[model samples]
Target: MRKSEPGRGLSVPRTGWRARIADRPARILLLGYLFYAAVGWGLLMLPVAQSGPVAPLDALFIATSAVSTTGLVTVDPGSSFTFFGEIVILALIQLGGLGYMTIGSVALLVVQHRISRRREAAARAAFELPSPVSIGAFLRAVFLFTFLVEAAGAAILYPMFLRAGVESPLWAAIFHSVSAFCTAGFSLFATSLEGYVAHPGVSLTVAALSILGAMGFLIAVDIWRTLLRRRVSFGFTTRIIVSVTLALIGAGTVLLALFEPTVAVLPWDARLLAAFFQAMTAATTVGFNTVPIGNLAVPSIMVLLVLMVVGASPAGTGGGIKTTAFATLFALVRCTLRGRRDVLLFGHRVPAEKMRTATATFAYYIGFLVVASGLLAATEAGAAFEHILFEAVSAMSTVGLSMGLTGALSEPGKILVIVLMTAGRLGILTFGIAIARTRPDDTAAPQPFGP
Candidate 1:
């Protein structure tokens, strides 16, 4: 080897994964999730993590689902996994829901009392926070809010679980509480929330936690600022997210209540409650269903499909195209219909960047849904086209509702869904960007478009 130049250290140039993702937050997030999923898969594959031998693919599927907080299960988690495995899944859910960077940042804050600029950039990208919001404040609020809500939810659920004759009521309550709040929808019960259809206390409590989690941390921060800190008013994004969420929930509830045959057969009080629970679950992308989703009529299915596509708000535990993006699409249409150029919502003009992002998100979602659905249709030749489409949407949206198709998926189908869940958890645009090639001169001024 050549001798080093005078005053030149022997440090070799940084190369490989670290250098590649150094400045790329999207790549960092994407790989971070993959790393966690891989670790979770390995841990879950051990003998101690399983009650019985689990197929490798199924273990990987469950691990991915937990890390994505998507809640789709190839096996009944309760029966297939032992206590240790369940804890592993729960840990994955918490990590997934909180996000890899978020947890890392919090830990750093606790230990070092300061976050590095690079880590701060990653956290900002992960959350897509507004310029006015400080990353430190937001992360602290997120941690506190998550634990408080989860604790309260568990407390409320403990007595309900005990009354319902559940085995290990305390553990069941705690597990389900975290699951709901994370909007992970992983249930210890074999039939999800179906057994609690008539239990308004449980249904509503779980629904409340899911809603709170899915509403996005920005909303919580906004509320804290407005109500507690005496800030001037709620942020525009918060207002829109709340409005769209409530509207979707309300619309889904009414449509399902009116058209769902299963809900129609229930007693009047339980019928409305079930419909509301199903609607809220779908809208929040929480995946818990009080009624059997498989037996629902076409109209009810359609309603759920819409809700899943719209999904929860941005910077939230849940996933989808997102409420703001969906709202922006509607605003664009309204403006275009009136022969105007400015996209306006709730008296505020939408920024051009936001409009473009919304349009791209909508296009990507539709494109991915169609492609995945067609592939599923081809792979599962005997399965109904409707079910294939539903599964595709559900997987891509990270809304785990299935029409009795999940357990019976072919190997290829399972793999496809795994990809979808990963993509869904990593926002579609972020996933696309992470995989796409980039130029060193990306900061150069934009050039005119050409056909």
Candidate 2:
């Protein structure tokens, strides 16, 4: 590893990792995600995936949602699929959740983003790297972490499901494990584990998969390296993800239990468990819901709304504002409250640019949710605006948990979600990567631009 440059704090020197990330492979990964989404959409348009050839918009919607790992389906995935078709959707979910690029770029990057300037910028922003330069090691680390976790989750789950007497337990176990880790929330079951609502083994296993997978590959890498060396650097992502994740879980637990008395049918312990589970489910962007989210108290709905907005870790399948983004935003508020010059967490100063990034992410996320929800609500019959908003958020966050409304969406409603899912799966900023233009420092001339 190259030594740090003179002025940068905690950022690795530019010539090493950054340069590698700026190669063709990284660009390929970025392009692959869009391509895969298109393919998935194309498949959904086929009669095999649906009863008949679906309307282009509806087919595209289902495909994008599956590829994005958002469970906001316009049709019932359970009923819409023939065995072969459902398998394709499941495969798309796995691919989408793991990130088509992240998985496709499985081999470590050597030199990436060599051709596309937009890809370099997108990769830099997406990975939170200091430079858009190459980082073979980091990408490699991320892929390794992902594979191990998914494999481990699958190993544990498959046997359990088998013992529980599920036919095709092997395939079911592998699919769900991958889905959970990718935080895609696409399930084979029609009602999404409604039958296993309180099955501690099943639900808890899924929950563990959700949490671990949504923790973010970067965090996982950090944790593994830390454990190996018996020390932890306590990087910003680690500190924030750990603290905020815990707090959200606690807050969610209390809010779900306090605000919803409907779960009283379940024992207090079970209800509490379910409440905490929902909290984690939302925070992590893992769409598995042991209890139906729609039937809950309105307050619980609000709580979930907040949780969904907060979302999961960065650089992984889960979506939303992300824990770090919210953590920084919350810190900015804290700094204002204390009259401090900088936002602080774990006694480390949050960077000024980081605060801006957080604000932008949060803003864009909300903007999309609002517009998409409004569009869908306008098109769908017998759907509440709030439900539309929830569905939009689910699609945008790539969190698939939905009210029963999804199966009945109009063609237009389905198209709206398809757009949201594609955007969400691409991390909202990827479009920035797609649209952004960059100039070399040497040849770049000063350009007049509006602020």
Candidate 3:
């Protein structure tokens, strides 16, 4: 028998080990989140990070929520966290909402003066930016637009906060502005913009910021380009996202006004304000609520649940299944029912891969929603089933709106929610992909994410 080369076999195992670590981008992304969450959790546990001693679980919960940009909290951040703690949370929200990959690309651009092909590939994989939009352009536009919009929102909110007797209006304005634009839904006010329900300026400004953030950077870039160039050439995705957003907002506003008895009792102007704000909150996956979420009727809650699950557009700050996925699945069903082989959007054929991804993602969301809801039901059995289900969907969607159940959840229930919130913010498919490792070769190849 011929002797094998001495080092060749050893080299194969080393190569295989490196490939396992390097190739799984999805797993790496997931680990990035866990690492970030751990860091944030430790920071929150520091004496300066909170006003008083905090339970490790609660600290972890807050860290996960902040890192995921899911606002479900067991404690009131305003009363419980110190100024330093709030700053830490704000930083987490920024990092979490923009995504670590996008920020890393920005850092690369700053340091290297250009993104390497690998970095570009990473950004593209993370954000799913289409061919028409270059990574540099998208990064620049998203950063510029995010700050500008946040600045505008802060400018609008500062005076209102001052008038409302906030001790540190500037801080309040900046905090709320960033929170709204990131769709993080973390608020200094314990009631969560409830007192501002009748105040159009504050409510509307927050809603507008939420809308912009949830619209996704792609749509923002499209809008900015059209306005700057005096041209109107938006893509099909942008068109569908805008159309669906407006329609959902309109329908949600009407439904909330009609079905919510508390909202119905308000004067016409107040009712309109409540309706609009709630609609915006639900559709954008922004958790700020003008009306008491618990007071809403069952049907009204169902509407919100649907909106939360449908969520915002792809590559956006908000979470859930996404607007385009909902559209794709709807289109798929329509085509299939009609015996049509191709799914057509704006007279263009939709790719089969996207359809399958959308279908899988949708199924993932539904399946998980049921399992999580059932688990919550068992753990927090004392709570109403509807409220438990609502909480589960909200956490999974990264929408923070709750029916007063978050604080009452058992420790295990809270942990479950933390997991759901993390999963929701990362996205169902992304979470799944991260857990299910692919072959080294498969990981090396570029794979498309769902729309």
Candidate 4:
């Protein structure tokens, strides 16, 4: 028996954590967040990163929010973070917004001056593009489009910032432009866009940037190509995205105007601007509120809730279930009701695989929303259900529009929110995949390709 026991060490080991992490794309994405969050937390903890010592939890919280681009901050970026720290936050926003994959590809392109097969595959996976397009071309389009829009937005905002006599107008304009286009919602002003609530130029510029970002880079590329080529045709996905976005904006504005007496009581110009800003903010998931979010009527908040949950389109800076997914689910239901064999939208059949994914995504979103809200409600005893629900939805959608409950959340509540925000940004499917225990390869052996 002793001699037989001696051979135990000769057997091969099972799969390791490294293999699991390396094999799953979702795990790579999750690990990327942890790495970035750790770096950000360390940077933010530095004395130069802040005017005073920040609690470790607060530093970690801010780092997580910034890296997720969730914008659900316990501490104000403008006051809590020093200039160096603000820059760090801005850098995190950009990194989170543009996505690490895209940024890595760009850096690779710069350093290597050639795209490797592995790099191309990584970019393709990160972007989740269905059809293969040249990775270099796609990266270039995204990079150029982003900078151009942000630059234009900054130019539009500079005069307004200067007119308002904001200290460091240039910096304010630059920061806001990046924040808006990235849909990060990190404002320099303690009151957010409240100071510019009545200023059409400022509100409009911010709204424009948010909308453009939320439209998704694919739609942007389509629009650009259409204009450049002088063609009117666009893809079905692009049509659905644009149509839903504009419709949400219009419906949200009208609903807010009707429901919120506070907004209705403003002067005609101010009233229109306020409604538009709020609508755009919700629809785009930009999270900048010109008016006091806590003062919003229940009905108006409901409208914003729906908008936030629907969120922006796929591949955009914003988060939530996404516009296309929502639309596809609607189409699927309509087809079932009509006894049709296939889901049709804009005269094209929606693929069954896409429809299934949409349905699954919707289910996952609702599941997360309910679970997060329940956890928050249990932890935050004194908070109203409505406020807790709003906070939960906002955090889960990465919309960041709070009903004044964010700053008052208990430690448990904050942890719940952090989880929701991470899930929202990483996406439900990706997060699920990362956490799922069943590894596909381990379930069964692979068969021949032809079979």
Candidate 5:
């Protein structure tokens, strides 16, 4: 006899696709993407969304990658997506990178009304916003930040592109503007930024855009506000972020330069520029590699591995433990060394709960990458562990760098990478909460113990 789930339907089982999607987070951003994905899927089915109508799986993949801001694409983005499709993809990337809640708040404020509490709360939790804000204030800051950065980035890049003589200056500017602002790091060309290895105009501009995007708007606002005040003082969080970011950039650049001996041959200034650019991009989790990464020595690759694991700032575009978590964790270590009772930074003591969250986040990140690498080795047969780790790190960080192995991956490998990209973009912690199985009743037995 066949059994069915509780109350779905006669024809369709209770454990349907719809049921699975329902229990996910209250983050409206995720749901909004699903809605767009369905629409994009339907669009693909139409004769116009594609050259000959893309397969459902490909459409869903494109939609997920764009909306999630994960640049792992099986189909060539330039050839398959038309102007309309490209617009849709860009819109999804911008909205996804900035969280739909952000866009909603911006819209509400544009019309001169308050944002709903639900949206503000979701946005707050995602970005760890410190204060309760009326939607208009929050919206103004977000739109302002986005426009200023993207516009500045485009202005810097347009002349460079004109000099390079790319076919469509307008299209190139727009594509890059969206890519940089979203921290998507996705390029229309197949080679990514490989051709721009020595072009500081291209590299520096992209790196700046990525760094700004990954810092998240709140941090940007904080830094900007502080700068505007012309004060030497900083808030606790801002101090932590600034200090950690500078340290990471310095350390990461040194390591990258030391590891890549070939880069050592370049003029000191040029090498310094490349190292700084690469470090900034990696730290921000924007995987635009100006230099050919696959040829890097193992030591250089290791440096990149650490940077990928560390990841970027909170809530902006990049992924990983975030600069704050790293700072908090580092403080915890320092506190232990100095034998202090609390993990303090910038004269502020971090809460115990935040420590737990940071530790858990780091554990989840490392565990996911290790397991993913092991599985890739099993399925990929002849592939080395280095390549596997590279693939895994690239996926989990949503960094699009590859070892010339992306095209060689089998179907199963592609599936694994896709899962990693989605997980990385949505966040491992977020997924854990969603699929977590437990209740208050499931707690361990309470036995009285005398120690």
Candidate 6:
């Protein structure tokens, strides 16, 4: 008998597409968002989902926007879609806000009473959780906190909407509450919260929800442990997130109050409240505007652009380069300028890896803004440069704020914004990693000599 090869008896592991995708957490996240976007697109295309005839591309744009939680609508959602469609959009917002894996993990926990190692790994990767944080506890906290906060928001808004003579007060309350909490920014009113600009209760409640959501689930978990469980101290990450968030909101509010022409016309109290609300919405990436974005003076628009670019904290419902990344970049620049070898934030040393990641994130964001803005300018004839740039930044940051350009976007412009929103939701770095080939870490490798 011919002698068999020594290794021929060994069973080889399968390397199918599913197995390949399952091996990479980033791939799983990318595919998950895409899958949801496709499903949402299909649902929105149904006749029952619409009150009026919707074009295929517009449906796709709405689906992608909802799934990304970017809220740059080509059509007025309230008038264009039926109750079923609005429900579909709201569901997509929740899914996107929670991180797509969160719902799956929650469902698995309910059914199996445990999450698989692979699933947990994917969740961890998606959230970029630190090694010390317990995945199970974190996920449980996220679900509990999100529901509680959203419910409270809805309850508070119900009476306010009822008092406002809204036709569907209860529905409107629930929808806006969820939207605000998710930082999804979808408004039933065509004018957003402009009608409630002077209603301090409504504006403040919505702002509170947006702030809490933008602060991230990690902070919630930290708070729960420190206060409720009495097991741990407040974390450094929480401190950084809180301090930076507060600083931005305070500074933006002051600047807007002093400079925004629209706010200048309001009564003193309303002006301050309007400034605070605008600042909160921009920094939180909530995107709801109480004033006309198109009419904002150049200085005010610049302030909003800065706020939107910095955006919310890590693992938060909102998007952008993120507050952590912004903090890291600021520290890196400060240290470099001072000729210090170590990068420090609040007297604590930032890890080299974190510094590198922050730098990469900043580079990617600025680079994409330039490229996308250029393409948009090319596609949109006669549009002002600032308007085109604003649209690009808003989409890339997932801020959803527009200067009246969203509705007038050319077909190519819509496609470009769709890509930007998807990328922003996935995170520029995470998306980069998902598409790029895997490579071993070279952190410890010796540097090559160069001139």
Would you list the rank order by TM-score, best first?
Answer: 1, 6, 3, 4, 5, 2
Q: List the residue pairs that clash in candidate 3.
A: none
lDDT of 4 by residue, 57-130 (tens): 88887887887777888888899989999999988888888876788788888888777664565566555555
lDDT of 4 at 32: 77
Write model 3 residue lDDT over 223-301, tens digit each, in one string: 8889998999698889988988888899999988887897998899999889989988888988999888998898999
Off by over 4 Å in 2: 1-31, 44-57, 108-122, 130-134, 429-451
Candidate 5 pairs with clashing backbones? none
- List the candidate 6 regions with Cα displacement exceeding 4 Å: 1-16, 229-232, 438-451
Q: What is the Cα-based TM-score of model 1?
A: 0.95
- Which 10-residue window in model 3 sums to the lowest lDDT? 9-18
Per-residue lDDT of model 1, residues 1-451, tens digit only = 1245568866554556666686578888999999999999999999999999999999999999999989999999999999999999999999999998999999999999899987888888777677788899999999998999999999999999999899999999999999998889999999998999999899999999999988889987887788876765788999999999999999988888888889998888998999999999999999998888899898889899999999988889888999999999999999999999788899999999999998998898898888899889888888998899889888888889999889999999999999999998988877887777777788899999996
lDDT of 5 by residue, 346-451 (tens): 7788999889988999998888878989888988988878888888887788776777666577778877876787677767776566556546475679778887
lDDT value, residue 333 of candidate 1: 97
The ten-residue window of minimal lDDT in model 1 covers 1-10
- lDDT per residue for candidate 2 within 126-201, as digits (tens), equals 5555452254455677767777877887788887788878768887788788878878777777677766766777
lDDT of candidate 2 at residue 177, scale 0 to 100:
83
Listed per model in order, the count of residue pairs whose N, CA or C atoms clash below 3 Å is 0, 17, 0, 0, 0, 0
TM-scores, each model vs. reference? 0.95, 0.83, 0.92, 0.92, 0.86, 0.94
Question: How much does candidate 2 score in TM-score?
Answer: 0.83
Q: Is candidate 3 or candidate 5 better by TM-score?
A: 3
Q: What is candidate 6's CA lDDT for residue 61?
A: 95
Relative to the true structure, how large is the alpha-carbon lDDT of every model?
0.90, 0.73, 0.86, 0.83, 0.73, 0.90
